[model samples]
Target: MMKIYLALALWMIIAEHELMSGAELICKRRINAEYRASVLMSPGYPFAYPNNMRCEWVIQAPEGQQVEIIFLEILTESCCDTIELRDGNTSSAGLLARYRGNVSESIYVSTFGSLYIKFTTDDSFVFNGFMAQFRTATTKTQNCTVKLDASDEPQLLTSPGWPYGYENNLLCTWTITAPEGRVVSITFVEFETESCCDYVLVRHGKSMRSSMYELGGLLKRPFTDVSTGPIIQVIFRSDSSLSTSGFKIQYKAVKRTKTDLMEIPKKDKCTGKIEIPEAGHGTLTTPGYPEKHENNMNCVWVLVAPPGMRVSLWFTSINTEACCDFIKIRDGETPTSKKLGILSGHSTKFAHYKSSGNVMRVDFQSDVTKVYSGFRAVYEVLNDSSEEKCGGDLRAAINRRQYISSPNWPNNARSLYCAWNITADEGYSVLFKIIGFHTFRRRDSIQFFDGESAIPFASLRRNTQHDDESFYSQSSNMYVIFRPDVTTVQGGFRGYFVAVPKRQRNTTPSILVSNLLGQHGRDNR
Candidate 1:
């Protein structure tokens, strides 16, 4: 029998000083506590491991269940240092995997009752280690592909065996067709997959060879699409290597009425110009505030807060014809000011927008057809406090530092959708450091961007409970956004932002090193 080396966290806690510095932990202390769900990391995660270390672990699941393992990150000596997975409790069992180099993927296998993992490293250099998660699942699984036709009813589609890494070398497809004179809509609730390599391909018609229309990408963002005709097909493919959380989509068919098909004349009731008072806040609605808006209309709203105070807009509801009839928000009074973001589709959990100055403009345009319940938004004047309210925009002083927190933070907080635009003088950059963080897993996120863009340079979401290290900006402007789900609120996040002179950023690290050396000298004396 192969020797089982168990290096657990709780054991290290009990004997921290006695444990060797290069030793790695293979499993957790309690079998029952970690049996259901747990994440496993290579010996020293987020850090490189020492040379000449060998580790082995045997994972045993409940009878009649299989074990699934997912590698979050894997980097090591490509040929020498390797990690292997076997299907039995011993080395003599069938080898399920032997991996090295830059390999990151997920695996699912049945070892009858236990799965054996072995890691070997020679006396040589090292790199950042691996991290993985292991869980249990039933032997019976869903098919790789599914088909649906002649159905107008709503249905749900998920990646084969979701909430787990999908199987390797798999292709799954879903087809939906409306009864007659109806339209099909596919709304992806959440989608995360390996871009290009493993993806979900969408077609406007019935088959893989459909030429009417085709739309497919890695679907990293939440998306919803309405087919141009009655038939729609979706294909999901996964290679033999890496996999992701996959996706869950909702599909339905809507019957087309006469009003939905024909172009309605523009109504003048809510299609005229509107302006809010200079004192500060008010609400605005589309042509029909609570009802489906009219087509072929144009509306504009100008918000003027006090001269020094900026304006903030929050969209409480947003449902347009997505891309076709859309709302545009700008930071200034003119049509050429910084365009904040084009609003379309369903409202996101976080829908807060802010102006860089006291003046902001909003323009809404609808095509001749296809309209949904229009948007309802409200604007407020931002105060002068360094600590602004949650869900509004905030700016940091060029030479000073400030703190930001979620609404009711360090305690149960409200569903928060907030943004902070930290800016500095022309030769400066911004530095952000997380003080603390806690939120509902998988449904909330705090993202950081280099400029006024939607794509984030880095983000902190749930499941990563560590105090985030500080982030230094390459530019003078930085944007931070916080979005939390509606239910199951938790103690939210707090962080500090400071502006640093770009010229001094390089020397700042040396200054810290000298300070550390001085402290060590004093200790030695």
Candidate 2:
């Protein structure tokens, strides 16, 4: 006859140490308090183990549902990881749980009655709080946008290509610094009048991957990074047109050293500009190499409209709404930018004489030398404004001392798409562009696999949460949720990648990261 053990404990782990370091409560919750405790685990009392290592405990359950325990005294540690249930099993040998001990790890036990669960660890620095709470079973939560004219964290800083103007597929540059181990991802959401198109996402300077609608593209591979976050270059594009008034990349994490954040690269600085030939259309700043702004709404630049120079300012605007959006153009150093004219049309494209667009003919009218410029617009954003969609913002970042590694320069601009339909804790199919990679260093047993070179989310392995086959259908570049704010790149994600490359562009800007700005940030220069 075989003997079975049941583990029951109000408290599983009890570590009463005098010289305890690298120990943490992490987070804990009573079951039913919040359904999010674990997308995979059921709502119940948060189960935790207390010993320094070798978790040992038991739980008493009602006679009928003993098989609900997914894990028992699950022990987690940093550095290396492994999985060992009460049945003396491992991630290998086709077990359900494996531990690489690299990123993170946990142990689980399954049974309905009283079960004995124990776990141990080698790293003395880690001690996670495995919570076991009691709550009713619920569905998973889907991430949604929070429409805002006001936000907890305001824009603080921005570039010229916002509000009413975007270059279809354009490249832009930004700089930032961050501490080690932090995550940084950009956000571009908007409430358009349903007339605008969907936008694309990119990581300029690093990888150029458009939206992922399907799974089998060469651009869906997973990339790694070693640099501190507040990563420099991140790109975004408009899938459809939209009249964006606000944008932001909510704060996340940064993992690097302090030294690296302090001594970052110094690219083009926002300065006064000089007049140059065919600089740009529609009143662009010259003299100042990198555009500079003192306040959130103020910037300085030099514009030229010489006598008989045959030059006209060009721009696109929102025409669906009854009222008009204003772009002010001014000359001189009055502490502001000027709007040469208004793009009062409904369409987003503009041309000179031979087309159906708005253009300000430079029949040699405006002054030449007194070439200073400023731009501004104040108007209500209509509910269904058939203008632009999607908005983005500048979040936080950190830097490190040691430089991150990488593969080749300008990783091939891979384009892809995805289509997913998921419910609750079940989510899968990750479409990403690779920038760098490293070796595994933990004991893990989660069912996962890799795709072809560029098409990462294409293929996968069979394992626990991932084995359900539903994940493969619910993943796409535009809809990635978990770790939504984190990205890895060669030489660290902080190294930077250009958002918009010159080859494929119209208005969707690019991201260029050369060096560190001031104190790990550029305030959108």
Candidate 3:
């Protein structure tokens, strides 16, 4: 079969550090495929060793379908000669990825870092899922990251008590390995389930019926099983510290017949737009109402304020899920004019699970104010992680905190370093990039928008593909940053980074650059 490559970048806007330390936004993107192949991060050009990268691919054939997974020789087999696929200390296998530097031995991280596999049509395979997290390049090295516990024999079985939403565990005649002398202390750390207030168990070299432990353990830690029942597992870790080191697990009934696990049928795919109101009825004026996406994205009702009145746009998604998707709202010119609100992946990054309207108030003076209009927020949705990210409902906790900065610049950077204008306890945030941005190179002062005017803090990302089709070549690389609080700041506050993506080379000829004006005011505010 011919190979078609698919590259997806989960672009998110990050606010300044108002949150935690050592926390970097881990952007994760997943795709379900039937087979596995070599998937690693390449740093564009050459680098010392490889671009210290990690990739995960689902390989085992799902139950019901006998299938075979295939990998493109062009990408994987070529480098197979020099690359390592599994952990170093352990007997190697070309089927899995190798664990090199930065991989902690205490956790399955070394094995989880990067993985590759090949499937055959004769072997059953089903869906393929991918994960992309805006995680720190640094690995987690702690004695308590992954916990495991077991007697001797281990077995693979399903138990509703498995932590991290899983209902299965491996109890069997499994083997355990650790980093050097850490093995004895690295038994089964602990297993806690998101479902209940208790812990579950899995025995080694046994079956589901035998892998049992009581709920509620005094100490919880990371763990791993070597081999249990039919499923052979060398490494297993939870989303949030399930198991780290080498834990065995036998294969489950998730296997399928090679023939049944065919390509995803197009008929079952997601179709046209979902009929939902952009803004749930949180609060609205007689003139200003929620934006709905029914008619060709037709946004009705312009700047209609009864004499002297201030409009409060309360979003219902403020506490619900409508906020996970994307929508648009505009005023003054056409609905297509400068977008008043264009939510980015930041919405999902925010620890706020409240679905609908997080408020955006605007005071229009006699309807003559430039942005004399309101907006309907378009949302960004979720795949793997849920609304309870970094921390949930951050806005509702703190309100009205703003901070600015003075930062480092002289480098070949696109954005300036501005100190974050944030308050310790306030529902506030640092603005990264505003939508409706007008990049002017001709003049020093750039207009934030081309038309009448737009609102502030209204989320936006450059449509480089459509904006400066010539200058902004890498629309994929360019993204915005948004920090709700210093606590939400994952790693150390590295300050806001402005990136201008470079395009691939010109094979023949592309679009021409138009003379554009310059905008002097940067977000270094």
Candidate 4:
């Protein structure tokens, strides 16, 4: 029986060599000799494979048997050329392994009746391809857990079926070790999985109690984390149902220096109450300001100014998931405080706000689906004075118009800095008409913004006459800023605003009422 088996293997090798010498550019074959080991090779075994070549091979075992494959050599372009192994007969089956670059000898066992192998090359570089041997085994073995030692060069780690979704009911773990006096760092390049039923748990040490992160859901951007020590363990788990494209990670060993051992500065908690310094200025940032924030976070921050002073906040940057996350600002310290604005999505420009009283509250909430880099803001305490008293929150009525003007408008107003927020009812937009416009030709300006964004949509400056010129808001709010040089005194601008349906005609005439009685009559009707 041994002699016959050896002869059959020799015959298979001769046949494969003859086939390789043929003119076919693409090669495919199947092997079902359950009792004899068979060799699999790329289109050109010891030589460089041709560019744009694709080859496939299927090895099948009899009932109650499993297929095992051992790699003898693999050399290909780092990322552009590749080899893939699946557990079943088709490409859609659960992935067993993927290889690129020069890999050491490795072994893989199929969980099903057959194993599928595919080799593909791009149009660019080519290299000496892979060679493996496969045979059938009577016992089944799971090849899920893997241990790796980190080196100066980075290494790639991926889920069982990365790029393609992983299989269900999987419990895979990877333990990475770095040399003494060094630490391990892992960066997630792509991440997506079942939000509720799949998770990747990372631990700084070998034990579960040392877990540093339990990550799931979808990450919109790449982020890196360093382990506390020289060892880290990552575990991936999935339930019996739905799956998604799993995660891809790159890891390397980095030396720990003196700076790493020094005491690090403390960061503010995710939820806290802060008091502004006597200097009346400070800054605040989301938990992971420069990096992607975590999923499913609800953080709140309250800022208290000195007695009799109000808080003015400026957001330098803001980026969050557009649909399921928000940063809400309020006028007071409590959740029930009057809302100022709800900001979300990537901010194209900076945003600024001021509270009516001494306290302001900020609330940030994120859902479990996706995450992005959050916001950064600064605050200052401002006392009520001539320069700070011109701007206030204004609500527009459907029938009556509200008017706003620069400080001491129609007069020589000087040293003024003012801002106004105009809001209309839901489903309505603010209509602003400049009834009077006059300012120093080159020393004063009035700017208009569409919503909470700081990017101005329009501006009046340089003695430009804007009387009877009108603008409309894209949403229920509009922001305006009026500023004049402290050295120049000039006649400022005036504007009237009213709430109108979004679909209303821009040519619609403004409704002007003279007295409170007429306004009340219109409101009552």
Candidate 5:
């Protein structure tokens, strides 16, 4: 009886092995029309799959029919074990989708007669593998594709499975048609999707070739666009991983006239040229700044600094309709110059932009739609010669030295606000040493920042004196600022900087002096 029991146990083990091996073999084959509907699974499926695996399968439908795959269950090591779906019968076919990790129920359809699937695993952790089924389906049977016709009333469109989050591995197309002599216009009400893998594409005509715009990510405000012709196509695609709440849009057909196509002049409240005074600083604001700006605005402000100086601009407050309103900055006097940046959205954090020459142009444009509190920016002129100025953009090189000092340093420096931005190449750090420093202990201050951050990492105030102090930056950039109260003035500060290899940085204060002396000695010799 014991021998019989042992034999039964051995047979059971053999049966389990056979099942596992059979599943592996089944995963690496080609299915034909003989099997109109079938299942594909990872080896040892419903259990943790083995590590280090590369399996492939091809599901082929009859001619004129496409293949559709439905994933009923999916679980794998996130990002390490992956499944790739292709549109043809071979590995080199156009990739349809790729998936990893614990994916929810999803579906994929092929554009042709065959669908190829590949599963790969790295030599690490494992998890319960996936189970999917494939079947043949015609294009008309697809539920996600739809067509709409023009009407006096607008039509509202939404992503499939809206609000509940869309399924993965989806390619949904929506085509809108207008009557003869009319065009289509679409206004997005809400748009949010998996930014990296899900997007909505807009095209001008019935075919997919005349591309108009592709939009993704979370939309902060409403967006509107008009089609050029009587037909428009919108396509939304999501890959085989994450999903989001999707989008909602209202589309309508409109008759176009000559007046609608022509550009009309907009009345703006603020548009002019700003000249920096001798103090080398000035401020600019949008129309009704600190409050909602007026719509249909087309404002321009050209800032001119004194000759031989550059313009450094910083925004203290910014809020606007993120979609249709903008503040565009150019690096020179006219719109044809290189664009520095386009500011939109809402942000209270301070950011800095500098021009290459003495002129910077700012243009503000708002569509006829929404409005929000506008922006306020301050501009300062930076002297080009370091010997005659207290602040400028400084670059440090290996084994080389650079110096910065207060305006008319070694003399009593008065009311001033100056800044110096020091940077070094990657894999290196900046070493700053104070050769001479003296400031009012109560009112005057000097700040040191590790990067472009608004907060300073170190500071000196309250009658501080550091004749031979050193500071090391954590990264490749450092920012220094000096601000003195108007009441009293003292001998300001002087500092020299050098770039040091991050791997061999010396933090000792005395080494800075020795290094500087050694460089000076080399220069003298």
Candidate 6:
């Protein structure tokens, strides 16, 4: 028997070599339980196989006997070049195993009867393919179908005959039930299937009758579905055409937590109020101004300009917690108004807001932790007619104060050139108070001139440190000029000028002189 096997093996090798080189020969032989082989090689034997080739062979045994095959070496183009095994020779035979990837140890057991092997290669990457040996098994094994049931303890599931293309007209289903209030997540370690013709469907719910969501196509990565409750069902179906290597899936169940829920800030209980004047503008800040704001707090500002004019707002700076804390701008004063946009995180670009009517609302909310530097914005009247032209003349009575504002004050000040000639009744000095100021630092400016010459008494820009301070002019006639560039715009200044009578005696000091004269004067004498 051993001599006969050796002779057949040598003859098969010689025939394979000749056939690979385009030669043909005829031989008649029958394989039975006694058939065995020490080695089997691809067509080219030890040399690299030619590209774009497909080949098949069959090894058979008697009834009630299985086949066992072991790989000695395998080198081929990874996935693109494949060697596949089947349980029988007929077209109805089911797939058993497949080889790809780099050379590795491989062993396979086939069902009763015979095992068929197929090798295919692409146009590129030719390598010396695999070599293996096979023999008929002396004992019987279980049937080829696969079954799986996954619970809290994770389990792996696959197609009917994994690592190989499933037989035609097959329907397989696996049910996975996790603990109550927990969801299942499926991670694909390996996957391949006929995309539309033969597919795997994954549905959520206790059964298919309840709810269903298909797993789409074979994925290269893992997929987790938490929306579906605790139950998941997977179904695999194959058609009667081309088959492919199936899939391997790893599944786990995860519990629901508090973070999964969404958090909405309470707007009705916010803590700020803002009302910008028709010709005036003002700066609004988060609770802590430039510092990080407190967590778990909601701040709201209601901005109202003149009746005919609309309100405009722009953020000078914003740094806040991402997602958890945000600033929402609205077009109207109520909660049901049209929503503009919500902003959060550290942003380099600026944000601008415009109201449809005379009123606009802003709301800010913070979460439990990770507070950051809040925000500062200026809100002022958007004068549709004025075209953001600042500077004008002002005349006030003695001991009276008059309001003055930047062009389109509170709104973004565009490229502008304007001047204000402020005069009191010839005898009073002018006092200027900086109410709210924001502009391009140093580049855009508001200057207080002594008279009409180029010399300036005070120059102000977006310097937050000193913008809030006050400045007084010695002369009754004061010239104020504002020039803003178009490239960088910001909320301009809001201020007022008050006229005071010159050389007015200090009334409190005069009263002190009268009180001291009657008693302290006699003691001094």
TM-score per candidate, chains pooled: 0.28, 0.17, 0.19, 0.34, 0.36, 0.39
Give one digit per residue, the lDDT tens place, for model 5 in 159-227: 988878988767777889998888988988999998765777677774323534567889999998778
Root-mean-square deviation of every model: 24.2, 33.1, 25.0, 24.4, 20.3, 24.8
Using lDDT as the measure, name the better of candidate 2 and candidate 6. Answer: 6
In model 5, pairs of residues that clash are: 441-462, 441-463
- 163-213 in candidate 3: lDDT tens per residue? 424322222122322232221111344433332212333333222222222
Candidate 4 per-residue C-alpha lDDT over 1-525 given as tens digits, one digit per residue, 9 for 90 to 100: 999999999999997767655515446777783657878778776888877767787888888676767789999875457788876788766555567778777655554568888888876678989888888753312566789999899999998888989987676778899999889989999999887657786777774235344678899999787888999887676756698999999999998766555342233348888888545346677787779987767788999888887886766568887655788898998876877877877864435578998899999877555788897776766433234348889998897876676765555566678888999999998888865565544457777787888776666654433455577777899888887877656556666789988854444323221222232344331
Q: After superposition, how far is residue 381 of candidate 6 from its true place, in Å?
A: 4.3
Best by lDDT: 5
Runs of candidate 1 exceeding 4 Å displacement: 1-280, 384-525
Model 6 Cα shift for residue 426 (angstroms): 5.1
Q: Number of clashes in model 5?
A: 2
Higher-lDDT candidate of 1 and 3: 1
Better of 2 and 6 by TM-score: 6
Candidate 6 has which clashing residue pairs, if any?
Answer: none
Minimum summed lDDT over a 10-residue window in model 2 is located at 490-499
TM-score of 1: 0.28
**How much RMSD separates candidate 2 from the native structure?**
33.1
Worst 10 residues of 1 by lDDT: 25-34
* Candidate achieving the largest TM-score: 6
Which scores higher on lDDT, 1 or 4?
4
Q: Residue 407 of candidate 6: its Cα lDDT?
A: 65
- Candidate 1 lDDT for residue 12: 62
Local distance difference test scores for all models:
0.65, 0.25, 0.24, 0.73, 0.74, 0.64
